[model samples]
Target: MQWPDLFDDDNVDDDDLSEMTRKYLPDTVVWTTDWTTGSLIEQLERNVFNVDPPFQRRSAWSDTKASLYIESLLLGCPVPPVTLAELPAQGSEGNFQYVVIDGKQRLTTLKRFALDGELKLTGLKVLRDLNGRSYSEVEQEPEFRRFANLPVRTVVLRNWKKDEVLQFVFHRLNTQTTPLSTHELRRALLAGGFTDYLDRESASSEGLQRILGISEPDYRLRDAELLLRAIAFVRYSNRYKGNLKQFLDTITRSANRSWSEPFARELDEVVGSINSAISAVYDIFDKGAFQRIDDEGQPSGRFNRAVFDILVMTFQNETIRRAATADPQAVRSAFTVVNRNPDFKRFISGTTKTPEAVNGRLRIWWKQLSSALELPYESFEQVQTW
Candidate 1:
């Protein structure tokens, strides 16, 4: 369950990109616009632009970098254009017209300087004379007044057929610069009720956070990703092939769009079941619930994603949850045996994203667990489609 020792290299399979390309591509219109800095700052002040969209990375530039950017603007240096996806206004409630898809750092810097009056230009090689001056200090000056009139280029994506297309575009846009993680792209591309629900649930789930060793919301969205992984496996493991990332991505986008009362209720049940399973694990393994078992029969090492996947998914069954809850020690003992099984360890440690490895280990663990709990043992073929 420990991350396969670094020395234990295995050939992980690639996702089915051909399938993804066919599914994700959709017809969309792209257009360009020029916004003066003064107008853009006004939009920032009025909240017409969503600068801090959930998919964007946090402002990463140091004060020095931000200062350099401001200098570039003042010196009339050409900067990369910002990209935005125009949100539908029907349900927007006058909140925002566009979400920043790229150039968040640059837009944020502009807001800090022009709107917030917080940035003081420094480390300016070209504008050294203005190094220590804030925007307010130079606003009345003729040279600095021209800063507001600077035209910034922006590209907008509109008339998209699906949210997934935006997600795909965002992924492509950031891949060369600051690459977005898979979860980050998902969050950006699928910003509907289901993703929103995941945000709320993952933030509030004490048990899930504790098991995953997170105290606050994970900026990387790892906590949400884990929850999604569990849900995806529980709901669609039978349909999974070797492409773990695409599988999760496809499901997340679909769920986000299709989120409804029934879907929410079903997800709530799954979350509750997961919580029940976590409670049972805590009773037995304590903090070691999702970690590797040591030779001394104690939980050891970091949390294992593979272990978490199979164990939580299995224990989520109501019958299994009850069985483990009734006899925590038996489950614990069964875990020790399963943990030490050479084949099970192999499946978890190396190139474990494939179907053979994923389902193989689940089968092994379930066989041991069912015997330990004295429940009817079901084959993975029968169980996975659930």
Candidate 2:
């Protein structure tokens, strides 16, 4: 059965895939390469049919994966196979165009190594021989040399179209038992330079844990994963499911790569602003004269989403910064006092009217807080709450 047929817009279980595999040889699927390979393929490439644009983001497979596969093939271990569907050209110059509906990462890496020879690995594992042997003994091991010399494999697909590719992706997303997520499909379908950059940034181990307050042990959420979630929430809110992994895999790849440098710089700046806001709050909670702690000695605090949103807006407007710069702790103390009152939630709710209305009121409160804290006052900028 064709890949599209396998994923028939309904939930397809492992049984379906197993049965399909029985009927079809995995290697029998057709795939073809552009005449050129590597970075050249990206540069010289134009959509012949133009029915579907090649996704802007190149494949996200890293050198590490290449290394592992090279090592695996060297060791004679079978790699997981992927599917390629052929397209019958509507009388295009070329006989066919191949759609890598699956196995994008592996195929991309193979193409890269074959064409440009830019070998680098990040996440792949190092394989070792039993009895602590290593492939390092290349002179002694014929198998090692054979493995090291494995050539890149290119499959050819003829007459592919954009809509069909997209529908195939959607169908795959819905039907597979352990289906590629909508985000993953999105990643595969949409192409952009920023995709790989975001994928790499989101994969960082140390940078994320600090940002998300995740730790080594007693783990639940991962810092890297949470960062993806936060970015998704801030950007295309509610357009995709809340699964951060898929969001990172698919959407991150399709983002504009040109925006990466500025995005990172802006991200750091925003994080710094949030830190300042958090510090301001911490100071208020520490005020022994005005506030007391709970039994566990953590601050008796109510850091609701509304307040968090308000804090984020400090980065949004420069006015909020100048207003909170001087004796910022006192500014936090005022809010803490309001929070401690029996009617605090009601007061905030009444003042803002709704969650969406908080930013405007926050700007006003920021002005008041600045005045009380001996900071410069700036009038609130008008914002459309909705």
The numbered model that scores best in TM-score is 1
Among the numbered candidates, top lDDT falls to 1
| Cα RMSD, each candidate | 6.1, 12.7
Tens-digit lDDT track of model 1 for 43-143: 88887777656533334577899999888778777888988888777454655377677776788898889887888988999768888899988676566
- Evaluated against the true structure, the overall lDDT of model 1 is 0.74
Question: What tens digits encode model 2's per-residue C-alpha lDDT throughout 198-284?
Answer: 345444434343333333310212222333444543344334442323434444554564456777676555444444544444443
Worst 10 residues of 2 by lDDT: 216-225
TM-score of each candidate structure, all chains considered together: 0.67, 0.38
TM-score of candidate 2 relative to the true fold: 0.38
Candidates' lDDT values, in order?
Answer: 0.74, 0.42
